[model samples]
Target chain A: MIIARVTGTVVATAKEPKLEGMKMLLLQPTDASGQTAKGSPVVAIDAVGAGLHDLVLYAAGSSARQTEITKDKPVDAVVMAIVDLIENQGGISYRKG
Target chain B: MIIARVTGTVVATAKEPKLEGMKMLLLQPTDASGQTAKGSPVVAIDAVGAGLHDLVLYAAGSSARQTEITKDKPVDAVVMAIVDLIENQGGISYRKG
Candidate 1:
């Protein structure tokens, strides 16, 4: 899984039926320090009800569909977990609360 | 799906039983021009019969398990298609044959 931040939202009126009620969020991949990663942001299906700026754990490719909400959907990325904290290299890299 | 080139192979004798007999390949993500992508090479399970240096389409996330061979497995990435060509901007960006 990749650590990312829910930067924003996306509303696609025209999409596959399987994605009808799924929430799409703009995700900015983040390093352990919670800084923006190098790659361009990706649009991911929100499965864990993460809010804007919330740190999240997202899965890409086929793994994105493993969630019950995204099963059989054509979605390629999904926010699977809401991260509360991240400790890296014995240092507090990030914390939500 | 992301486009990638199979670079090498991996042999893991100890793994989940569901992964028995599955082929693992090292993949280098590629651009439309077939150039190496920025991220580090990833280890992916081959769902299709792709060869070394073969350009392939891979799905990551839960979708990786959607295939018959990977269903219920802990795999995170799968090579799903062999690419014949990649045409971009009205130009032939890549071709296999």
Candidate 2:
């Protein structure tokens, strides 16, 4: 899972039905500090209740399909968890309330 | 899971026989000594045994359909797990063996 920030949402009317209720958000893969680390923007399937500016953990590939909502969909990068904290070897690198 | 490399390979004849023996390379999502931190090439779906340059661990949406060859198909990113080491705190930034 990579940390990211939700910038906005996308609506594709022609997408597969399995992707209907799912939220597609524009994400900037970030570090623990919630800053862009890769790519200008990416489309992600949101799950972590990620608001417009919330830090989130997004899962990709088949794992994104693990949810009951995205079964067999052509979706990638689903917000699996909201990053409440990140403690690598660096002390208290990030935290969320 | 992040860290992988497999510089070439992709064959698409017709379509969807569940990706038709599914060997789509030209994928270059790498890290941990293989270079390219963010982008340049992002067509993963290889596994741990990835040849032509190892170091891999890729997984994206729908869990890549949690496959015995992507059961539900429509794979996002496969190649899960292949990092030998990744120590932080600015000590041993990355490693593979």
- In order, the Cα lDDT scores of the candidates are 0.74, 0.59
TM-score of chain B of 2: 0.34
True contacts kept of 1: 0.15
**Against the true structure, whose TM-score is highest?**
1
By lDDT, who's the top model here? 1
Q: Write the per-residue lDDT of candidate 1 for residues B1-72, one digit (tens) a residue.
A: 566778999999988888899999999887655665746799988866788988776667776776677778
lDDT of 2 at A77: 66
Q: Which 10 residues in a row give candidate 1 chain A its minimum summed lDDT? A: A10-19
Residue B46, model 1: lDDT of: 80
lDDT (10s digit) by residue, model 1, range A1-96: 989877665443333334567776666678987775746455678888898878899887767778899887655788899999898999899999
Q: Is the docking of candidate 1 incorrect, acceptable, medium or high quality?
A: incorrect
Q: Number of clashes in every candidate structure?
A: 13, 23
Estimate the overall C-alpha local distance difference test score of candidate 1: 0.74
- Measured by TM-score, how close is model 1 to the native structure? 0.55
How much is B36 displaced in model 2, in angstroms? Answer: 13
